[model samples]
Target: MLTSDQEIRELLTAARTVAVVGISDDPERDSYMVAEFLQRQGYRIIPVNPRLVNLNIQVLGEKPYATLRDVPEKIDIVDIFRRPETVMPVIEDAIAAGAGAVWMQLSIVNKEAAARAEAAGLKVVMNRCMAVEYRRLMPR
Candidate 1:
């Protein structure tokens, strides 16, 4: 819903560390591929997935965290890959984790959650693809 290219560019340029919620281990998955691309672009990727924690495995060379609260570093952007119905709790966690921004990936949108995040002073972009936005906004 955030349509300003300048704002999106600013947020993406400012972000250095991204915590990818619901990231997958499978490379074929959109979450995994996007996270990988970000990692390759030098973003510190904090993978957050309960399944990965349950499996006790790392993804993309970083230890997988069960939740945003478990991540030690400051999260510049919390990129969510979960369903719209399940995003409120994740946004709450992102706020608690002190993230600078929240990005709900393509096909995922929660107006209430986005409003809450913005009200809490965190920049938000819902129903957009982070990797695509990065390519579009960041200088190539």
Candidate 2:
């Protein structure tokens, strides 16, 4: 787990793109809202939801991927919104996708997945909101 503010900042700053797993089509959902927020903050957001394949590209600027593996380009950060049980496979996919960091959203935590991602050389940030942290760490 990344402990220092600098480390977290570096990860957030260095990342150019984020793959938002389990992204929802509904704007009311946290997944969609966070993805929108991150996109607004200049993180190229690639929304991922198996259910929203056909509408993905039309909605999200970048074409949405059904799975992380479905993404073509390099993924710097993986923002996951799935359940705990769903995270391990997503982490495996993130490892395979060569993402530098894996961020599990607020109220979400998967210890095994976090440890696994960290062991695979990816920075793991669990139980944190990306938008909130971005606000806290980088004061505009």
lDDT of each: 0.93, 0.87
Clashing pairs in 1: none
The digit string of per-residue lDDT tens for model 1 on 38-104 reads 9989899999998999999889998999999999889999999999999999999999999999999
User: Which portions of model 2 miss their true places by more than 4 Å?
Assistant: 54-57
Per-residue alpha-carbon lDDT of candidate 2 for residues 1-140, written as tens digits (9 for 90 to 100): 98678988888899989999988877899888888888989899988877788664444555667888889989999999989878999999999988989999987889999999999999999988888889889757
Where's the lowest-lDDT run of ten residues in candidate 2? 54-63
What's the distance in Å from true for residue 37, model 2?
1.0
What candidate 1 gets wrong by more than 4 Å, as runs, is none
